[model samples]
Every structure is written in structure tokens, then in C-alpha cells.
Target: MSEREVLELLRENARYGTDDIARITGLDEDDVEATIAALEEAGVVRGYQAVVDWDELEDERVRAVVELNVTLDRETGYADIASRLARFPEVTALRLVSGDYDFDMEVEGDSIREVSRFVSEKVAPVPEITQTVTHYVMTAYKENGIEFGDGDEDDRLSYSP
Candidate 1:
């Protein structure tokens, strides 16, 4: 079985069983299982995640994209700050990028005030951080493989279960 094919299939749906993958990829079920095990050992397949449409829930999630400008600590580079911020439960994702900002951060909270407090108290306090800009997400139309409300009259759920 080709590892890339297995990886791609898993990326589309993490719940795919070895038998299903074997059927689709035209590979032996045992081989598909072995490849997945090997990839997991190598840390190539990080983990599985479910993309739920939070809008339908009674408890809404507030997400924000935070842009940070930072002065590199010559000794520590970006690792120090990156790992530090990554440890926070509110930080869903963090990346060092090239653009107007040095770091792109995704954070979420139960409420806007909670997210705001996290940014002001947790993110901005780092000494190397020079500036921060936060943009709140108003709505999410599509996430992962699911699409939010398209407002169709047809009898299809807006998102896949």
C-alpha cells in the first residue's frame, strides 16, 4: 500500500477502517494497517480530529486570529515564545509565518470576554512580543470537510454528520 494514499484517505476521514481503506486504495487490508502503524510510530500521522459546527450548539465558541510582531531573542530564537504560547489551553494553533506579522495564532474561548482576557493577559505579556492584533471570527461557513448553512430548500443537512 502507498503511504501517501493512506494518508490522504485518512486526512479526508480519520474514522476510515483498514478494510475500507483497503477497498478504496486497492491494497491489502493487512498492508494498510501496517502502513498506518508505521506512520503513527514515525509521528507522521499526528492524531484524529472531528470538525463540529459550533453554531448549532447552545454553547457558542469564540475564535480569534491573533497577529503578533516580535523581536527575536538572539539566544532563544522563536522557539521559546512559540512553545510558551502553544502550552495555553486556549491556543488551538500557532505558526511562525512571513508577512506583516511574525506569528499567526488561533485561539478560542467560551466567550468573547474570555478570549479578550486571554490575549491581553497571556499573549501580550511576553517580553519579546512587540505588538498584537486580534480579529474575531464572526461566522464559519466551511471548516474541514463540512459546509455551514447554504440555506437550501432541498432536503440535505447543511453539514455532514
Candidate 2:
């Protein structure tokens, strides 16, 4: 199997061992192991993480998407600003985008107040940041291509007035 196939299989299920991947992809177990090791060494595969449903847990957590409009510096531009934003522990994802906003940031905290504080005290205070609009996530039906709750509904109850 091609390297792309191996990568795809791993992406679908990170827990797949060399033997399992080799068996499924029709590649030798040694080759599969070597390919994975090479991918890791070359930085093609960065890291593995489990997708957790934080909402289901007892701990209270809040997630917010903050859109930022910024004045880009002539010398370094958005990279410098984006790198600075990425250093914050609360920031899960950060991207420089086109159109209305210059940057999009995803932040998580223990509470709504904590998220608000991050925007006010940390993000908003940056010199390059001109404007910010924060939107808090209410309910997550799907995340990272995985459906959060039960499968699609099949039947609906009807009532006559």
C-alpha cells in the first residue's frame, strides 16, 4: 500500500498497531512499522490525542470562538501575532484567515467568566488587535467529523389539535 493509504488508515483510527495496519492495508508488518517511524521522524505525523467529550463530564468547561481584526505590522505581519497568541494555554486553535477577520481563535476555559477574562485580559490587550467578537459554543452536535450524541432520528410523534 501507498504511504497515503497508511496515513489515511492511521487518521481514521490512531490506535491501529503496525500489525493491524499491515493486515488491513496488505503491507508487510515490518514495512508498516518502518513507515510509521519514518513519518514520526520526518514530522509528517505530529502527535496523537484522544477526542474527549468535555460536556459529558461533571467538570464545567466553556469553549469560545474569538474573531479578531488586527492591524498587520509591515515587517513581520500576522505570523508574529499568531505565534504570540498560540502560546496561551487557553488557546486550542489559531488561524490567520481572509475576508472580514484577520485571525480566528478557539479558546477553552473552566467557565464563561474565565473565557471572558481571557478575551479581556489577554487577547484584547494585544497591540495589533483592533477588534474582537467572541462567540461561546452552546451545544455540539458534531466535532472533528464525529457525531456527539445518538444517531439520526427515524420517527417523529404526531399530535392533532
Candidate 3:
């Protein structure tokens, strides 16, 4: 429970030092440090990353969500294909998901043409991949449980069914 609480705090802000975490969680500073170390060793805490609002940057990379349907290989399976896809520097994230597609992929490039080329040249050529539908990310309002942009005023309408 304590570990979960610590993780939640870290998720909110990865920059939280031991003293801050200890203060927030009401745990001793030394214990907080030890717990974090243990979590990292256990791979419970994979990595700390800064969530940047790429739209704010003048030179932002083009992003897209690609839905891919695949025919799974008997011997190799998902692990091998997923590994192959992940090696590409353009691939931001990939997941084997349930629904219309076998894989949900996030990729980035300098332009839409670059991403298209990657799909045509790199991804589609794989024997297992049958079809791919790409959806370009126009804007990211929220990600990783954190809302993007400054204004917090709720714009959602309330209704009863």
C-alpha cells in the first residue's frame, strides 16, 4: 500500500526527491529513498520521463496513431514482431491490443510523408502485418493522466440519460 502511494506521488511528478516524497507520504526520508531504490531494482518503476507538450515547440515532430492488423507467426508470435517494430527510432510506443487491430502504434517523424514512408517501406513489408490504418494526432489535450494546456476550466456538458 505504501509502495502504491509512493508510486502515485512519483507518477504525479518524477522530480520529487526523497525528502519531498517522505514529507508527502509521511514516511521517513531514508525509508523513502530505500523504497524507491527497491522499486527501481524490481522494475516496478521502469523509468522517469518528462511529459512535454510538443505542440508548444515550434519544431514539433509529426505524430500518428497506426492501427495494424497482423497474422501471427506460429513459432515467433507477438514478442518477435513487437521487438522488430520497437527497434525503429521513429516508433514512439506500441501495444498489442484487443479490438479492430492487433497492434496500436504511435510513431513520430519530421513530416507526414516521413511517417507514411515508414509505414509503406518499414512496417508493411513485414509478412505478418496484413493491414494498417493511420490516424494522425492533431493535438494532445491530455496524456499520462495529466491534462495539457494552461486553462483548466471544464468545457464538458452534463446530461442525464
Candidate 4:
């Protein structure tokens, strides 16, 4: 298959195995593997990720993003502050960015109060975290652009673009 065909396959679903891609594209398994490897090396295929349905989980968990305004102390390193927060399983993703907030944290908890406690007891106490402004997600309109696909009954079941 052509490079365009390979890219379309990869874009549709990066998680597809080489054998599956070979089946779809009519290319040999080794060729498919080489193409995928080349794309990854070129940074086109960055990484693989799982999309979980949080609502289906047994625990009642609420997702939230906490914007932290921090003052990195000379004594405490940024990694050290991040390490402290990471100890709690609730904190999911942490990133330091340039903006009003020093760190953006994605976390989950059973309730608002539980999240509050996590922020107060677990997060705020960290040496660098001087302030935190939280915004709780009331509802997610859509996640990852997966909007139930087209409602049209006639659409083919081919892989997504």
C-alpha cells in the first residue's frame, strides 16, 4: 500500500496490530511493522493510550482539573513537589505549564468533599503549592471527540478517520 494508505490506517487506530493492518491494507506483516515503526520514529505515532469509561467504574469518582499557583522554594524541587502529589493514587496527570497556574493536575475522587480533602490535606500542604483554584467538571459534553459516531443507519462500519 501507499504511504497515504498506511497513514490513514494508523490515524484510524494506532492500536491495530501489524497483522490486522496487513489484512486491511493487503501488505505483508513485516512491511506493516516497518511502516508503523518509521511513523513512530518520525514522531507521527507518538504513543498508545486507553480510553476508559469512567462512569462504568464501581467507585463513584468525579474528574477534576486543579490549577495550582506555586512558588517553587529553593529547598524543595519541582520534581519533589510532584512526587509528593503522585503518592496519592487520585492524582492522574500532572503537568507544569506557563500561564496563570504553575501546575495543571487531573484528579478523580468519590465526591466533592473527597476531592476537597485531597486538595487540602494531600495537595496544598506540598511546599511549592502556594495556591490552588479548582474547577469541577459538571458534565462532559464529549470526550476525545467520540460523539457516538454518525446516527445515519446506512453508514459503513469501516474504521474511523
* Candidate 2 vs 3: which has more lDDT: 3
- For model 1, state the Cα shift of residue 122 in Å: 0.8
Put down candidate 1 lDDT per residue, 50-111, tens digits, no spaces. 89888888998999999999998567679898999999999999999998899999999999
Q: Pick the candidate with the highest TM-score.
A: 3
Q: Across residues 29-105, which tens digit of lDDT does each residue of candidate 2 receive? A: 99999999888999999998887777799998899999999987677688899999999999999998888998999
Candidates ranked by TM-score, best first?
Answer: 3, 1, 2, 4
Name the candidate, 2 or 3, with the larger TM-score value.
Answer: 3
Report every candidate's CA lDDT.
0.93, 0.90, 0.91, 0.79
lDDT of 3 at 124: 91
Q: What is the C-alpha RMSD of each candidate to the true structure, in Å?
A: 4.6, 6.2, 5.8, 5.5
Q: Which model is ahead, 1 or 4, in terms of TM-score? A: 1
If ranked by lDDT, best first, what sequence of candidates would result? 1, 3, 2, 4
Per-candidate clashes come to 0, 0, 0, 0
Global Cα lDDT for candidate 3: 0.91
